[model samples]
Target: MLTKKNSFSILAIGAVVASSLVLFINSTKKQESALPPARPNIIFIFSDDHTAQAISAYGSKLTKTPNIDRIAKEGAILHTNVVTNSICGPSRATLLTGKYSHLNGYKLNEKVFDVNQPVFPEELQKNGYQTAWVGKMHLGSLPNGFDYLNVLPGQGHYYNPDFINSKNETVRYPGYVTNVVTKLSIDWLNQRDTSKPFFLVVGHKATHREWLPDAPDLGAYDNVNFPLPPTFYDDYTGREAAKDQDMTIDKTMRLKEDLKVHADYEKSGIFNRFTPEQKKPFYDYYENKISKEFDAKKLTGKALVEWKYQRYIKDYLSTARSLDRNIGELLDHLDKSGLAKNTVVIYASDQGFYMGEHGWFDKRFIYEESLKTPFVIRYPGVIKPGTQINELISNIDWAPTLLNLTGTTIPRGVQGESFLPLLTGKKVAWRKEAYYHYYEYPQPHHVYPHFGIRTDRYTLARFYEVKDFWELYDLKNDPQEMHNLYGSKGYEAITADLKAKLKKEIIHYKDDEALKIMESKL
Candidate 1:
C-alpha cells in the first residue's frame, strides 16, 4: 500500500532499531561483567578413621568436639550419611569419581586407582574452580584433578611425615602431622588466586590405626575412664561372620607397637623416626609410668580385655584432640579472613570407625557402627543454622551434590543424586535406602566380603565369596543387630522384598557381576 520511497524509509528505521538492540545487549553484558561472582567457595575438612560416636555433636560422653561441632551448629547435620565401601582408599575413590567401586576400578585397598578415569574435581576445575588437596590421599598414586596437591605417601606417619608434592618430590615437614597439614592448607589459601572460586580439600591422618597423639596431648584423657562396650566380650553366639573377624581390641591390638608399651621394636621404625628428645618423653611416660603400673596390676582374661579397651580409647581420643583443635583453628582463619560467609564448610571422615562395637576395631561390615559416617555441612546463605537432616545419603552421591551446589553441570555416568534439596528443606522426594559393598577380606582385617542395603528401619546383607549366607536385621527392634532374621517363617515378605530391591539396585548401578550373583541366588 506504500510507495517505493516510504518502503525505503521503513527499511532504514528497521536498521536503526537493530543497531540499538546490539548496543543494549553490549551494555547489559558489560554490566554483568562488573558484578561479583556468585559461586561459593568450598572448604572440605576430612579426617581419617574418625567415628561419629567420637564427635560431641553426635552425642559422645567420652570426648567433646566443640570445633567440629561448629559446622553442624552453623548448618545441617546428616544422620544417615553412609559410604559405599567402609575402607580408606576405596572411599576416597568413590568421592572422586561419584561412581561405585566396581565401576571406578578401585574396589579394594589392594587395587590401584585408575587415574585416567574422569573425576568430579576435574570437572570442577574446568568450571573455573581452583581445586587443591592437602594431606593424606591414599589412592595408591599421586592424585589427578587438583591444581595444588601435597599428599602423604602410603599410610603416612603421624609425626615428621613425608609429603609428595605436585612436582613428585618428597618433602619432609617438621612438627605433628595435624599441625603441618593445617599450616600447608592455610598457606595455599593465602597464595591461591582469589579471583576464582576454590574447592580446597584438607585431609588429616589423625585417629587412624596405631593411634598416636601429639606430645602435648599424650595424657589428655588420662583423667577420664571410658566405659567398655556392653558387647566387649561378645561370644559371637549366632553370627558366623562376627566369630571370625580378627580386629578385636583384646586379641589384635599390639601393646608394644600400637599401644606405645615402650618395648623395643627397633626394626618397626616407629620410634626410630623420632629424635632422642622425642623418644625420651615417650619412654618416660609409657615405660616408666604406665608400663610400671601395668606390671603391678597383672590383669588377666576379662580384666585384661577391659584394661586394653581403656588404653586404646585414651590414646585414640588424644589423637582426635589435635584433629578437633586444628579444625577450630581453620574455622577461625576463615572467619578472620572474611571467607566464612561465602565458604561452604564441610566435615566428614574417610569412613566411620568402630569404637570397639561388635568386639571389633576396624570397619568392613554393613553394621550400623561401621556403615554410618559423620557428615556436617555449613553454607551460610543456603543452609539454615542448627538443621539436622534424616535423609539417606551415600558417598557416591557426594560429587553430584557438590557439583549441583556450585551450579556446574554434572557429567553423565555419575551414580549419585544431589541432596541439595534436602538441605534447603524442599519437599522433593529423596532416596529411601543406601547401597553398600565391601571387598577386602583375609588381609588387614579378616571380615568376609559382603553387600547389603540399609533402609530407614532395616538392613539385609549377603556374605559371599567364602560362604553363602544371608543376614537380616530389623533395625527398629534390634538396633544393635544381635539377631539375624534371614529365613524366619514370619519374615517371608520382607526378605523377598529386600532381595528384589537389592537386585534392582545392582542392575541400576550396572554391577553386572553382582547382578549375576544375585540372580543365581534368587
Candidate 2:
C-alpha cells in the first residue's frame, strides 16, 4: 500500500487541482474589474425658463452657450426632449416622479408639491446614496426626499435672494443668485459623506421673468442688434386662441417692470432689495445710458415693438451669461475633486421659453418653442463623445433614466421607461411620438389650455377652455407652423389618425380631465 509510484500520483493530482482553483480566481477578478462602478454620483443642473433656442449646442444663433455646450461635446445631446406639461412646477414634478402632471398632482405653478409621494431621490436614499437639492426649487411646499435643501422661497430674485434651508428658515445670501446657488451646491459636495455616492440638483434662477442681468453682465450684448424672427408679426389667421393671447411682445411685456425703463433704483421694488453698491451697476447702465436713449428716441408703432424686442433679447442673454459661467465653475470643481470620472453631469431646463417666436414672450402653449427643452448629459466611459439623439423623449423619462443609471430598480408607479440603453448605443424599441398638455390659463399669459400629440413630421392639438378649436400643422412642410391644416381638404385621414392617437395617449396617461374634454369638446 505504500508504494513510491502511488504516492507520486496522489501528489500530482493535488497540484493540478490547486492550479485550476488559482485560474478560476483570476478570471473572477478580471470580470469584476470589467463591470461599472457600484454606484455613480449624479449632478443635475436645472435652470428655469431656459429654452433650447438659447443654447448654442441646440444650434442657437441668438446666443453662444459655450459652457453648456461642453456637455454636448463631451457626451450626448437630445434634440427632441419634450415636456409632459410645458410649465414650471408640472415639468419638475414629472421629472421627480416619472409621471405626467395629472398623476403627479402638480399641473400648475403656485401650488404645493405633494411630498408624501415617492420621488427618485427617496429611492436613491434607500439604495445607499446621499441626496441634496440646492437652489431654485420653485415648489411652494417644503421639499422631502433630500438630506439637505436650500431653495428659493418662490421665484427668487436675481440679486441678494433669500434661501429657505432644511430648517425652514429663510436666510438672505449676498450675491448673484446663480453664483450663490453654485457656491452652496459645492459647499455641500465638499462636506458630504465620502463613503456614499451623492445626487445633487443645482437649480439656477437666471433668465427667469424680469430678466435682470448680473452687475458685471449688464450690456453684455449691447452691440448685437438681434434680427427679428420670421414670424415676428404673426397674423393669427385661422388660430383663434393665438389671436386672444395677451403675451405678445407689443402688449404684455411692460416697459417699467420688464424692460427696466425709467425704474427708480431707490424705490421699494425689485431694485430696493439690492444694497447701494449692488444697485450701482444697474443704475449706471439702465438709468444713465438706456433710459436716456429711450427718451430721446420716442419710438412708436413697429419701431417701438422692435426696440422692445432688442432690449428683451439683450437682457435675457446677458442674464444667461452668469448661469453659463457658474456651470463652468461647477464643472471645474468636479475635475479638480476627482469626481469627473464617476459623476454624471446633466443640464436641462424646466421648460422651453419663447424668444420672439410668434411675437410672444411667455410659455404656456404646446408650441415647439415651449414644448421642447434642452437636455445634455456627460457620462464618462459610458456615452461616447459628440453623441446626438433625435428620438422622442419626455421629461417624465428623466427620473427613470437617472434611476437606471445608478442601478436602482425603477418603481412600477413610474410611467416612463429609462433611456439608458439609447445612451449606451444599444438598438432598442423606442417611442415614435410624444404627448403634450398645457393647463395654466386665464390669468398671466391667457394661453388657452390644450392637449395634443406630436409625431416626427406633424403636430396636432385641440385647444379648449376659453376657446374650443382644433389646430394641425405639418412640421415638415411648414416648420414655422404659420399655416393651419386641421380641416383642410385631402387631410381628413391625417386629422382622424392624430385624433385617434391623441385619444389613445390620453387614456394611456390616465388623464381623466383630458379624456372628458376630448369626448365633450372635440
263-306 per-residue lDDT for model 1 (tens digits) = 67366666667667766777787889888888899989978878
lDDT of 2 by residue, 470-497 (tens): 9999999998888899999999999999
State each model's C-alpha RMSD to the native: 5.1, 2.2
Tell me, by TM-score, which candidate is best. 2
TM per candidate:
0.93, 0.96
Give lDDT: candidate 1, residue 24. Answer: 100
Which residue ranges in model 1 land beyond 4 Å of their true spot? 1-37
Clashes of each: 0, 0
Candidate 2 lDDT score relative to the true structure? 0.91
**Candidate 1 TM-score versus the reference:** 0.93
Model 2 ranges off by over 4 Å: 1-17, 20-27, 30-36
